[model samples]
Target: MDVADLAALETGGSLWTWHRGLRDGTAVVFDLDGVLSDAASRQHHLKGPRPDWEAFFAASGDDPLINEVATVLHLLAPELIVVLLTARPARVRTATLGWLDRHQLRWDLLVMRKDGDRRPARHFKQEAVRGVRERGMDVALCFEDDLRNVEMFRSEGIPTLYVHSGYYD
Candidate 1:
C-alpha cells in the first residue's frame, strides 16, 4: 500500500514500512542503546567498570547491527522522520549524536534525560514518547530491546518491535 494508506491504517498505528515510504506525514521513533546496538549485553558482560553501563556505550566500535539497521531505515523509509528516545544522560548528547552520524543514520529528534532526575528510566522514556506523540506526528513504531520500556510504550498506545538481542538467544 501507499504511505497515505499505511498512515491511515489505524490511530497511532504501526505497519511494516520497511520497503515503503512513511504515510504522507508520520514520524518513526526508535529506542537507542539496546535496540540499535548490543549495549545491554555488553553492559552485562563487562562488570569490571560498570560492565552493563560501559558496555552499552563502549561497544559502539564493533557493533554489527548499527549499519544494518541504518541501511534498512534508509532504504525503507527515507522520508519518515526518525527519533531516538533514550534515558542516557544529556551529558552524552554530543557523543550520541556523533555515533549516529558516524554510523550514517538519519534521525530527526534525540530526547535525553535531564541531569538530575532520579525517577525510574522507564517513566522518563514514557514521558519522552508522550512528548513526541503530542507534536502532531503519529508515532508509527518504536524499536526497543528493553521489556520495561516496551511495556511503557504499549501502555501509552505505542507499538513496539522488540529487537532480539543475544541475551535471550
Candidate 2:
C-alpha cells in the first residue's frame, strides 16, 4: 500500500489509544528518530559548499534492511497503537509529518519536545513514555537507536528495541 492508503487508515482522533486484541490488549510505542525514520543523521547539518542534505538523506533511505523492518511493523503490529516520541522541536513538525506522510508510515500519535526544557533528550523521551502509560495503555515495546534513550526507557520498566548504529551503540 502507499502513503495515501496509510493516511486513510489512520483516520485521526485518539488513534493513540490501544485497540483491544484478539486475545490480549497491548500498545506499541515507537521512537521517531531512529526507529521510524533515519532521523539520527538529521540532527547534524552537512557542511561545506557541496553539501547536499537531500542526497545525504536519500542515500540513507536506500537501506533495504530499514525498509524491511518498517514493513514488518506495519503488517505485524497493525492493531497495536503506535506513538512517535521525538526530541525534535515543534518547528519541524510540518517537515516531520510530511516525511511520515511520504513514507506511508502510520502513527497514532506524534509527540514533539517543547522548547525551554532543561532536561536531556533521554529524559524528555522517558517522560513522554510515562505520559503514554498514564493514558491507560500498556506500552508493549519502545523502539530507539540511541543507547542513552534505551537506558532511559529501560529504567522506566519499558521494553525497548535498540537500533544499532556504528557511532552510537
Candidate 3:
C-alpha cells in the first residue's frame, strides 16, 4: 500500500505524518506513555467515570522521561529503526513532540491513535505494528508497559518486553 493507504490504515481517520520518512529494516517499537514518558502523575485523570482524556494528554508535555527507557532508545536509535508507538491520540502530536524534544528521546517514527478513534490500546497498537511491517520493516522487538499490548505483540510473533508502570493496576 501507498503512504496514503498506510496512514489511513494506521490512524483510522485523518492522515498525520511526521518529519521522517518510512525506513525499511529491523525496527524496535516502544510505547510512549508508560514506557518512555512517565505518565504516572497524569494517569489519575483516567480514573473515575468519564475519563478526562483531554486533561491526561494535555498534561503530557510535563511528563518526565523514563530514564532507563530513554537510554535504551538512544542506544538503539543509531543502529535500528526506533518506532515510538503510542495509544495516545494524534491531536496531541505537538505536545508529544515537545515532550520528546525536552527529554532528548529520539525515534525514527512515531505512531499515534487517530482523533475520535477510541479502540482499545491493544487493537490500535496491533494495527500500527502491522502497518509498520507492511512498509517493509521487520518489527524485531517491542518495549511496552501495557500487558494487553505485550500479549498482542507476542501473539503476532514479535518479541516484547513488558515494563510495569503501575498505570494498569
Candidate 4:
C-alpha cells in the first residue's frame, strides 16, 4: 500500500495511550496470526486454489494463545511501545480485539489490512512497519511467523525474530 492508501486504512488502538513509551525511541512490533496466536486450526481454510479467506479469518477467534510469544510481549510492553501489525482484514477487528483481550495481550496500536486488500502479506506488512517508522518510532525489533515477512523486515534492516509456525513451508 502507498502512503495515501495506508493513511486511508483503519487503525485501531490509541497511540496517545502509549506516547510515553515512544519517548524511549523504539517500538516492538508483533504479528497476530501464527505469531502471537496459533493459527493452525484456521490454516485448512487457506488450502486449495480458491482459499476460503473469510472462513480462515472467521475461525481466528478460536486460535490458541502462543504463550512464549505472549510472555515476551508482556515483558516488553511495559517498557517499549508494542504494535500489533497483522494481515488480517479490518472487518474482523471486533473479533480480533476480543481475541487479544481473551488472551490478556496488550498492544499500543493495532494495524490491520484494509478490507478487500489483495496485496501479499509481505507487501502489506512491510508498509505497516514503514508507517510505524514514519511516525518517528524506530522499530527496535519485530516478531513474525511468516518467513517471507521475517526476510522482508530483515532486508530492510529491521531486526525480526522468526517464530516458526509452518505457515510458509
Candidate 5:
C-alpha cells in the first residue's frame, strides 16, 4: 500500500501528520506485516497461528509500496531512529531479520511477541508502544495496517499512516 492507500484509511486525520508536531531526534515506527513485508498481499485465511506452515509465514517478499518507503527513509530520514514493530511471534525473528536485511531496511530496534504471550494484538502493541513513548523516546509516527492498532495509537496522540491490508480485503 502507498500514500493513497494510507489516505484511504483516514477518518479525516491529517495526511501529512508526519510533519506536524514532530520534534528533533524522534523515533519512527513501522509495522512489519502491512508496512514492510508482503504478508498483507499474500492470502491469509486465519491469522495468529499455523504450526504446520511455519516456513510460509517466516519468509516472504516485501510489499512494493513499503519497499519504496524503506528506501526513502534510509536516505532522507536517516537522522530519525527507525524501529520495526511487528506482532509476529518470536520464533520468526531470524527469518524476519533476514528479509529486512535483504531489503536494506534499517531498524534501530525490533520488537516481537514472545512465545506463550497470548494477549490480543491491540493490547500488546498498546502496552509496548506506550512504554517506549513513556521512556521519553518521542514517537513521531507509526505506519500500520491494522485498524485496531491504528485506533489505539491515534488515541494516544501518535500520528499513524494506515496502510491497506489483506486482513481487511
Candidate 6:
C-alpha cells in the first residue's frame, strides 16, 4: 500500500485502509454512533447513559451524519459489505432502523448489543466484530472513534482505523 494513499485517507480524520485490502473483497465494520452519527457527545453526555432510550431512539434528534463520513461510506458502498456495528441495545431496533432510513444509511448487517449482555462497551464491540468474522466475513478494517474499543480490537488482532470523533469540542 502506498504511504501517501494511506495519509490521504487520514485527511478526513480516518485511517481508511479498506480500499487497499479490497483486492480480496473484504467487509468493513463501522461504529455508527460517534463515527457516522453525532450521537455520543452532541446528543447526550458520554459519562452518563440516556435515561430513556426508547424515547430517545424514537425521536429523530440524533440523526446527523458526520461530514466526510458519508463520503467514505459512499465510496465503499459499491464493493464492500458495510457492517454497522453499534453498542445500541437490541430493544431500540425499530427506532434505530427508522433513523437509518431517514438518513439513507444502509448496512449489510446491523449488530446490536444482545439482551442481558452487560459487557463494557469495548468488549461488546469486539464481540460484535468477532460475530461477523465467525460468519466467514473477512473484516478488512474497522472505522471507530472510541480509543478503548480500538485498543480492544487491536488486542484481538483486528486492525482498526482511528476515526476522529466529530463529538469532540
Which lDDT value does model 2 have at 151?
91
> Candidate 6, after superposition: displacement of residue 136 in Å?
0.5
Candidate 1: where is the Cα deviation over 4 Å? Answer: 1-24, 44-65, 166-169
**Candidate 2 lDDT trough over 10 residues, lowest sum:** 8-17
Q: Ten consecutive residues with minimal summed lDDT in candidate 1?
A: 6-15
Model 6, runs deviating above 4 Å: 1-25, 40-61, 166-169
lDDT of 1 by residue, 49-115 (tens): 4445444554555544455556656765666777667777665655665676567666666667765
Supply candidate 1's per-residue lDDT for 111. 68
lDDT tens readout by residue for model 5, 102-144: 7766666666766556677778788768756764678999989
Point out where model 3 deviates above 4 Å: 1-16
C-alpha lDDT of all candidate models, in order: 0.61, 0.60, 0.80, 0.78, 0.63, 0.65
Clashes per candidate, residues 3 or more apart or on different chains: 4, 0, 0, 0, 0, 0
Which model is ahead, 1 or 4, in terms of lDDT? Answer: 4
Descending-lDDT candidate ranking: 3, 4, 6, 5, 1, 2
lDDT of 5: 0.63
Clashes of 2: 0
- Report the lDDT of model 4 for residue 4: 25
lDDT comparison, 2 vs 4, better candidate? 4
- Residue 119, candidate 6: C-alpha displacement in angstroms: 1.1
lDDT of 6 by residue, 52-94 (tens): 5544444534668776876788777576788777777666665
What is candidate 4's TM-score against the reference?
A: 0.85
Best by lDDT: 3
Best by TM-score: 3
Worst 10 residues of 3 by lDDT: 1-10
Q: Is candidate 2 or candidate 6 better by lDDT?
A: 6
